[model samples]
Structure formats: C-alpha cells, structure tokens
Target: MTATTAPAPSRLQRVAALAGAETRLLLRNRTAVVNSLLLPLFLVAFVPVAGLGGDGPLGPRLVVTAFAVTLVFLTYHNLVTTYVARREELVLQRMRSGELTPGEVLLGTAVPTLLVTLAQVVLVLAGTAVIGEWSAPTDVVLPLVALLGGMLLMTLLAAASTSFTRTAESAQITTLPLVVLASITSGIVVPLTAFPEQVAQVVRLTPIEPVVELARLGLAGQTWDGRSVDWAAAPQPLLVLAAWIAVAAAVAPRVFRWAPRR
Candidate 1:
C-alpha cells in the first residue's frame, strides 16, 4: 500500500486560523467593536481637543490615564463579554473537538485583542506627541512591565469575571465594578490632582492607578507642561501592580468556567 501523508499545520498556523475566525466574528459584533475601540478612541480624542483641561496639551499624567483606560476597554472589557458569549453559545465547548488544547484556544482568542491594544498604545503615544513635546520614557523597563502586567492581570480577571457573569447582556453590569473604579477612582476620567491629598493617598492603592502612574513615569522626568515628577516613587506602585497580578493569576484558573453555569 502506498503511504499517503498530508502536511500538518504548524502551531502558529493553528492559532492564526483561530484568530482569523475570531476577527470575522468581532467585525460582525458591532456592539463589541464599538465598546472596545470606537468609544475609547473618542474619549482619548475628546480630552485635549475639547479643552477639558485648559489650553495646555494635557499633562503626562492625564495622557497616561487615558491610554490605560483604552487598554482596559480593549483587553479586559471586550474579553469578558466575548468569553461569556462564546461559552453561553457553546462555541467554546464545540472547539474542544479540535487538535487544540484549552490554553491554545484562549491564546488564539486573545491575538486580535492584543493587536488592537498595541495599535491603541501607538495612537496614545502619537496623540501625545502631537499635542505636546512628549519626552522619551525615563525608564523603558518599567513602562513595559506596567503594560504587560496590566494586560496579564486583565486577562485573568476577564476569565474570572465570566464565572460570575451569566449572560452577554449582564456583562455590562458585572464589568461595571472595574470600569467604574477605573473611571472614577483610578484616574482614568479624573486625575489624582483633582482628589484631596488624603483621598489621593488612598486612591493610589487602587487597581488601575499603578498602571496609570507607571505610564506617566515612563514619560520624561520633565513634561511639556513643565511638570516635574519624582521618578523615585516608582517602587511602591510597581509592587502594588505586581501584587494584584499575582492574585489575579492565582485565582483566575481556579475560578474560570469553561461552560455555562446552568
């Protein structure tokens, strides 16, 4: 008997195939696209152009907060609804028939989201540069750590959030805790400077604050607004973000659901 063998797809090909399908689905899901991309961009574009903060090009801190919020919208908020919807529809369960592992499925799902987040970051940087004389990052490593950490933490949290979320519609309510906290307390919509000193001190410990602060610190020591901040204060926030990431990672896998609760 003649041997017949077909070429097997590589690992990257498999993930790419999954991502292609996911991208198509995301495109059709206009609601998800609007929530993740269009709205976040609107806020970022609105801040400085709307003159919300006066004639200045907006402070580095404010810029940082805006970008951090975009990341959360794209990575965390988007994934929560997507995962829940897929699980409820049994799409995730159906994928089990493939030659892929659970980890591969999740990783594949994230590729498009990650690419979109990277583009958002580039837009944030370019937008800041156009608005002001943005400086090169003071500490390259820390900013990278902050972005990567924030993404990882949010990923785990998204998966974990699905455990509590029962339907695609309810995701709006379940995700409100994080979205509200970031917008109100974590300096996304409002800056720390707006808060009273004592309140700001406590708010610094909030989940998204460190990532936002780290983003600010990544900019030059002296910003276009002639604002000078202490780079030496980086350690504390770094520790806070790292601690949260650890907690989320450890808890996510244990709590994440692969199927609908009912």
Candidate 2:
C-alpha cells in the first residue's frame, strides 16, 4: 500500500483563498454587482435631481446616509442572505471541511462586500462634493469610526437574519424589514434633524442613527457638539449595534444550517 499525505494551509492562506474565490464569484454576478453598486449611485444622483437640492449641510448628510443604506442593504444584508443560502445548499459545509474555518468563512465573505461599500462611499462623496459643493471631512476619524461600526453591525445583522431564512430565495423577502426601516428612519431620505424633537430622540437611539449623524458631522468638519468630539453622543447607536452583533454571533452558530432545509 502506498502512503498518502496532505498539506494543510495556514489560517491566513485559507482566508485568502476563500476571500479571493468569493470576490470573484460576487463580481461575476452582474445583477448583484449592479444592485450593490449602481443602484445606490442612481439614488444618490436621482434624489438631488428630484428637488432634494444639494445646497447645504443637509444635502451632504442625505447623500452620505443614502450611500450608507445602500452599502448595508444591497451589500451586507444581501451577502448574508446569499451566504446562508449557500450554506443551506451544502456549499459552506464542503468548504468547512477544507482549509477554511467558520471565522475565516465569515470574514472572507465580508471582505469583498466591505470593499464595495468603501467604493460606494467614495463615489457618493465625490458626487456630493462636485454637485452639492460639499467640503471634505474635517475630522475624518469620526466618520471612519461610524463606517467601521456600521460594517460590523451589518455583518452581524445579516448573520442573525440568516437564522430565519429557510431558503436562498426566501432571503430576499426576509430582509425587507431592516431595509425599509433603515431607509426611512436612518436619515437616508430625510435628515433626522428635520423630524420633531421627540421623534428625533427616538430615532437617534436606533443603530443607524449615530452612523448617519457621525457621517454628517464628519463631512461638515464639525464635532459631535459645538464644543469638541464627544464619543459619548454615539453610545446609544454603538450599543444597539453591539447588542445586535452579540445576538447574531451567539445565535448563528446554534441555528445556522449546513445543509438544505429539506
């Protein structure tokens, strides 16, 4: 009998392989690319043209919020749904048997989506700067914090949502609630500042609120308050996001299926 041997790749190598494959697959899907990238650009362009008027601080805020929504819904949420579907189809199960670990799988899957979001943010910022005459950010750290937090939150939210999704096709319908809520109340279509004080207060408690506020403040070269950068003002949103992340991380490992529901 001949002896058989195999080489195990390092963790980093496995992650890189998975990430590269996922990124290529994502790019090949024309519809997904368009929905993830072009749709948001269209909204960014159309909203202002439809009398939203990019003339002041609110204009840049709206643009950034819209861009962020697109990043969350089209890329983050969609990727989660797709990942769950793939897992249920036994794709993830087989991959797990290879060099990739669960953590590697999740992180690798998110890398491409995060890159797409970054590109979208750049496009939106450029468009707003040109059309709305918006200034570049003053305190870039604030918005970077928001973006990082938002990406992490969205990934966790996706994992949580996948637990409820029985099939790949069902993911489309299942993710609608978050999509709608984030679109309206997250300051995408309208500024939270425009809402009544009580309503704004309530909205500010949501996960997306702080992100939008931070992005707006960052773009305007302003701090949380007129005094200085108060990271405390962002606590509620960050807490909400962190709670969601904890829930998803805890629940997904328990409930996520590696084979088809049937």
Candidate 3:
C-alpha cells in the first residue's frame, strides 16, 4: 500500500475558516457586542449634548472626535482584552495545534472586530449627518486612507499590548494608555487646531494624530498650517506607527502564549 497525505490549505482558505469561526464566537459575547456597537453611539450622541457645539468647524470636529473615540475604545482596546482572554483560555493554543499559523490566528481573531468597526464608522457618519447636521467629506480619499492606516496601526498595537497582558482582566488596565491618549491628544476630545503651537506639536507625535487629522480634513476640509495637522510636515507619526507594527510583528509570535503561563 502507498502512503498518502492531504495537501495543506492555502492561506486564503485558512484565513477564511479562522475568520468565520472567530466571527461566530465574537457575536455570541453580549458584552463585546454592546461595547463594539453601543459605546460608539453613546459617544457620538453624548459629545454634542455636552455643549461641544454643532456649527461651523466645531460640528465636524465633534463628529470626528466621537468616531476616533469609538474606534479606539470599541475596536482596538476591546480586541486586545478579548485576544488576551482567548489566549489565556487556551483557545489560541488549541487552534495552533491545527494547520493554522500565527498570522492566520491573529487575522482570524481580528476579522470580526474589523467588521464591527467598519459598521460603526458607517452608522456614525450617517447618524451625525442626519441628527447632528454634519456635512459630507471634503476629500474622501484622505479620510479613507487615514482610517485604513489607523486600523492597521491600531491592530498591531493591540497585538503588541497583549504581550504585557497576563490575563484577560489585566487587559483592561493595559489598554488605558492608548485609550487615554486617543481621547486627549488624537483630536478626538480636542482639536489639534485649537491647541497652542507647542502643545499641538507635541500631540502630533502620537500614533493617533495622523488618522484624526486626516479624518478632520476629509470631513470638514480642515488642515493645520503649523505642521501639526499637515500630513507632510509630520511624517514621524507615520514612521512611529510603522515601527510599532514592525516590532509587534517581530515579537508577538515569539512572546505570544496560547495558554496561561502556569
């Protein structure tokens, strides 16, 4: 008798399988669902209510800020905590025993969250336009580019953050820096254009700056003349975001544990 072996699945096939499974699992979690959807809506609704103003440039700023907050809190932070939880629970370990690679696992885990984020973005834009009287994009391409880049950078940062997370519970605390910074400096809570020259310059160095700036420009045709909001003037944010992604990609595989470190 001749020995036989099955051919390995292609990367796309593996990713699809894993992503589908992950999506199903994510949907089952009520907390995840609420945070992913409800929180953004709350932010979008509440910010304007809190006297953030709804006319002129302030209107678009509030909308963009709300969107950024939603992205960071619901998508990025939530995913990290969930990833760590899954890892500690050995869900990742069991999956690794199969044909899935680490990249496949991460991609699979992130797919559902990404979908939720995209949906949230759409809803926010639509809702703001209807209720908050927001306008259309000034430069559609810029916002799309920023959002895509932001998602990529944030995903990698979440993966990197997981290295410090010993347990799912700890992930809540671990993700605070990004959450706080996103709110404070990413033009989410406050516009960079409104800041003093020195203060805005400092804020521009953060990872979330580029995305928020691009978003503002896209939504309201706003840009900074002092190199803070000017995308060309501050390439460091992009480079820093890229560097984090590269380092996370390099280190996550080696350090990532699929099960609790007993």
Q: Give per-residue lDDT, candidate 1, residue 220.
A: 41
Q: After superposition, how far is residue 250 of candidate 3 from its true place, in Å?
A: 4.5
Which scores better on lDDT, 2 or 3? Answer: 3
Structural similarity to truth (TM-score) of each candidate? 0.82, 0.82, 0.83
* Model with the higher TM-score, candidate 2 or 3: 3
The lDDT-based order of candidates, best leading, equals: 1, 3, 2
lDDT of 3 at 227: 30
Positional deviation of residue 237's Cα in model 3 after best superposition, in angstroms = 5.7
Task: Residues 15-129, candidate 1: write the lDDT tens digits.
Answer: 8999998988777978766655565456566766554421233555445655576667678887888889888998888886678777667777877787777666666666667
Candidate 2 C-alpha lDDT tens digits along 177-228? 8777776676656556578878877877666666776765565643323323
Off by over 4 Å in 3: 1-7, 51-59, 193-195, 224-255
C-alpha RMSD of each candidate structure in angstroms: 3.6, 3.7, 3.4
* Count of backbone collisions within predicted model 1: 0
Alpha carbon lDDT of residue 202, candidate 1? Answer: 83
Query: Which model scores highest in TM-score?
Result: 3
State residue 55's C-alpha deviation in candidate 3, in Å. Answer: 8.0
